[model samples]
Target: MKFELLKTSNAYAARAGLIQTDHGPVETPVFMPVGTRGTVKALTNEELISASASIILGNTYHLYLRPGMDVIREGGGLHKFMNWHRPILTDSGGYQVFSLAHMRKIEGDVTTFRSHIDGSLHTLSPEKSMEIQRMLGSDIVMVFDECTPYPCDYATAKESLTRTHRWERLSREAFDATDPLWGHTQALFAIVQGSVYEDLRMESAAYLTNLDFDGYAIGGLAVGEPKAIMYELTGKVCQQLPAEKPRYLMGVGKPEDIIHSIARGVDMMDCVLPTRNARNGTLYTRRGKINIKRAEFSKDFSPLDPECPCPACQNHSKAYLHHLYKTGEITGLRLNSLHNITFFLQLVREARQSIQEGRFSKFYENFCQTYPMEEDHSAKNAASRERRRKS
Candidate 1:
């Protein structure tokens, strides 16, 4: 993979770049929709393409546990198996094993845990993670590392960081030993884990950058930390990463969080917020997020978002969407998800344009004023975060 910086905002750390992947070029400041179990929940590949998604995320743990590697390997890797020819990024399954599985034990370099789906025992190591990702034929593979939970002490964080560094080394070696299964180039990106400690964050970034991985992902954030702390740590880490390489912020955030992270120089991010919330009848607009299930929308005839180019907004009214959701029609989920993803992609595209035009600061200011920064959504988001943790 190659990252070419095209432009940088003079007012913020925000930058616009292009990542050359084997599948295609992914524009920086990208939002990857979460496609955890091979599919992105309610949307298909054509729908994803129509929503302008250049890349999507898949979970290593989920795929490995369900269909297993043999099924994907026989299907000729994830791209062919899922019919998604665009760039795909897969996590190392480390987080899922630690967060979702029961009775997990870390012995030296290997982690043993019981499957969340069944009681079957499983083991994962850095080497094994690289091997699985290679078999899956992901365009970008993340190294296996322990994700520190919120409220962890310094000592625990330090120990996890040490193990993570060692695991990262093993991951790099394993990646070097393996080749892509589908005859396309693949890139390995390292994750920097330091919890919320500034010193540890810097140390981790420095150590990983010295290894010269294709990209760097700021992990162990947005796990429940305050928004301010996450942004502070992100800015600190991004400052240390190589300017030429892409900087990804993993498992981060709502629309506001995305805007903040972009200003902190994060090049890539993935989240289930837009999709998951869509299923629950929450819709994002330029003004703010609205719960379409609300009774007030029953008589409202306005479009979801008049300015939105998505079909949901172009063709459907708020009352109709409310009715579909209330009636539990499956089409409601699909249309809502499609609109949310479209809105997110458009937001990122607009941010890129603002950066190139040298008006990101103004754009940010105007967005904050218009969005109103709703607080009631926290309860809904918390439910999603909890599900993510358990997944």
Candidate 2:
């Protein structure tokens, strides 16, 4: 993979670049939709293309648990297995080992845990993670490292950071030993982890920079921490990383969070918020978020977002969506998911344009002022409460 910077914003860390991959070139400052299990929930590859998604994310943990690596290899890797020809980025399954697995046991160079799927025991080492991602044939693979939990004590965080550094070296050696399969070139990215400690974060960054992977990811944040702290850490880490390689922030966040992180120098990100919330009747818009299940929309005949060009907004009405969701129609879920993904992609595209034109700072100020994340919860709660009162 090769990255070329085209432009940088004068006022913020936001910049635009191009990532040249074998499948295609992905424009930097891009948002990759989560497609764990080789599929994005409620959307097809065609739909993802229509939504303007340049790349998608896959999970090593989930795929490794179900169907196994043998199945994926037999089918000629993930692209053929899922029929998605676009570039894909796969996580190292480190987060899953820490978050989902049961009966977890951490020892030297290997972590053993039970599958959340069927309680089957498994062990993942840095070598194993590299092997799984190589078998999956992802365009970009993340290194295996511990994702320190939020609010962890200083000592615990420091110890985890040390473990992560060691694992990173092992992962690099593993990737170097393996040859590529399925005609896809895979790039490995090292992750920086230190919980909320600035000194530790800086140390982690310096270590990874010396190792000099193709890219760097700021991990172990957004795990139930305040937005201010996340942004602060992102800024510090980005400053410490190399200017040439791409910087990705994993499992990050809402629309506002993306904008904030971009301003702080994150070149790429992926999250489940867009599709996950869409399934629950939450939709995003230029004006802000809207709950389609609200009673006020029962008779409303307008589109979900007049400014949106998604199929949901182009062909369906708010009243129709309200009815479909209330009646538990599956089509409602698909349409909502489509719209949400479209909104997110469009937001990133706009940010890139703003950066190129040297107006990112203005764009950031306007977005925060208009959306005001603090007011989002109150609006949604009031809408739901009003519906209950009427019922």
Write one digit per residue (lDDT tens) for candidate 2, span 75-166.
99999999988899999999988885346899999999998879888999999999999999999999999997655789999999999999
Candidate 1 whole-model C-alpha lDDT, 0 to 1: 0.92
Clashes of 1: 0
Candidate 1 local lDDT, 334-364, one digit each (tens): 9999999999999988998899889999998
Pairs of colliding residues, candidate 2 = none
All candidates' TM-scores?
Answer: 0.95, 0.95
Please provide the root mean square deviation of candidate 2 (C-alpha atoms, Å): 5.2
lDDT: worst 10-residue window of model 2: 374-383
Taken over the whole model, the C-alpha lDDT of each candidate is 0.92, 0.92
Listing every candidate in turn, what is its Cα RMSD in Å to the true structure after a full C-alpha superposition? 3.1, 5.2
